[model samples]
Target: MTRKKNSGDFLKECMADALFILLRTKSIEEITVSEITALANVSRITYYRNFTSKEKVIEFKLDKLISQWIHEHPRKESASAYESSLSFFQFFYSIHDIVQTLIRANLSVMLLNRLILKFHDFNTPDRNEYYRQIFISFGLCGIILTWMDNGMKESPEQMAETVSRRFFPQPEP
Candidate 1:
């Protein structure tokens, strides 16, 4: 199916595009609701109704984008565990823009913090889980940045294979 230039998705793309445009020229703190609304051609009423702050836009969009990416390219449940695990890199290819936006806003840390909170098993993060999330978050961010920095020269399939070979070596047989 094709995405069109009307309806809810269109409006979201417009708002996100506007935000990205504004983001390129100014820090999120310096950018205003009015500026985003004006650039988006979306009314202030709508913007305020959907977003409470500029950071909220990044939070909302990045979360939605990553979730959508994962849903669209989900790991095949029946695949071998190793193949399913490699499916993770497929997600990075799909979220380039949103990831870059988070980095540009200096909000990748916030995104990592949010992910840790979301994945916690209980009210409090156990020391083990906390450190696990911290390690994974930093490691994943490094992978994403390095991939981008290298201009995404490797295809997602290549990245997945490289990651599996480099990080998930098979047990000696």
Candidate 2:
């Protein structure tokens, strides 16, 4: 009997689990498509049908998560700039594990760089939002890396509050 094709979600989940396993054991440079397919217990054909490369898998996962968060918890039309910043940080914290894993895999920095560019395009300003977004993204990534290196001592909520305070300093009432 012919085996059924895995749904898109199922393939993505397999890829994610494979990534975690690969990140735990090997450097990103050493990982191959065959390894991912083997780890995921799916055929090479299946993996090729889903993603072009391992890097694409990581990028796809991050993009999907970011898009989903933006769709699900959109900032209020009347929300202040500070509120919007806080909301984003909160959403990032909610996905801290995946973030941490990606960081550990050395993909977080690359992903953050892409996000910085995207954020820049979204907010057109004379002051160079591109530079600002790059600075903020790198800063947050650094903070998370340090926290994880130290064993994630604080809760995500606590980290989010601290980041919000630093990035979106309270404005005068």
Candidate 3:
């Protein structure tokens, strides 16, 4: 027996597929909600119910990816700064393709700024912590953009190692 499809799930799948197609063919600025709905074979109402705007859809995808990363790499009880950096780099590497597309679409800078602010809000408890978080997030965005601009030649692991050395230098044993 075949299971019935849920309306919400169906709409999400349609949106995902449509976004993938859009990424390949056209700039985000050139795409419209009607076009997305047409490609997804869904009504405009369904699309509106699911997402307020195309940008929201992209935000939702990024948020989901970040949540998955947090789940996959929970902060250890004794997690050091390097471990935290590595965990984030791993997550970034996993979603590199989607990220590259966002970068190509000129959305990465805005997204990165928002993400850094979010991280600062979440991790910073006091004034000092706030500054530290802001600094780290800002620096991380620079490193990530550099990697993307350089065609991502090195593996994420190698990039993480470089970041670790630069930001969280190891002490001589």
Candidate 4:
């Protein structure tokens, strides 16, 4: 038997859809919770129950997308940085539509902030290691933003190879 979505779950999905639809034409700041609820056909109470603000809705959707990617692509036993970077670009390529939309909507910072939070090692007490993780996260975000800005014409494989060559240039024969 198939499980049915609970009311809150259904409402959250509606709100997210409404937000995305509105975002297509309106900036996030211009979107009000009332507008979201009205468009979603949900109640103000329902919106507040699921999200704190309009930005939270975007954050929720971003987290959902990232979670889906992580589930679909399990990490290797000992994946190299290049392998990870390939997967990274591949994931963005798969979601390029939404990525582009977010970029156009000027909400890409939410994506960057989310990435930084995901890469954060709360358990690590070493400052240098923490800094390294932040640096990598920022670097990846920069690459994605640039790619989206440039229309993302290159294939994910090409982007991955370019990044690899940049850091590990081949010596002249």
Candidate 1 has an lDDT of: 0.68
Worst 10 residues of 4 by lDDT: 1-10
| lDDT, candidate 3, at 9 | 60
- Tens digit of per-residue lDDT, candidate 4, span 26-108: 89889889999999998899898889888889888788788778788887868765787799998898878777878989889
Between candidates 1 and 4, the one scoring higher on lDDT is 4
Candidate 4 Cα RMSD after full superposition onto the native fold (Å): 2.9
lDDT of 4: 0.83
TM-score of 4: 0.85
The residue-level lDDT of candidate 4 at 28 comes to: 89
Candidate 2 lDDT tens digits, 98-142: 777777776777667556544446465645765776677777667
Local distance difference test, each candidate: 0.68, 0.72, 0.75, 0.83
The C-alpha TM-scores of every prediction are 0.73, 0.73, 0.83, 0.85
lDDT of 3 by residue, 65-170 (tens): 6666667777687876667777777777777887788778777875585576445465545888777877878789878877876788888778878888878887
Please list the Cα RMSD from the true structure of every candidate, rounded to 1 decimal place: 4.5, 4.2, 3.4, 2.9
Pairs in clash, predicted candidate 3: none
What is the per-residue lDDT of model 1 for residues 15-122, given as tens digits with 9 covering 90 to 100?
777887887768878888888889898998978777777777766666666666557666465675347445656666666766666677776676665554443344
**How would the candidate models be sorted by TM-score, starting from the highest?**
4, 3, 2, 1
Candidate 1 has which clashing residue pairs, if any?
Answer: none
What's the count of clashing pairs in each model shown? Answer: 0, 0, 0, 0
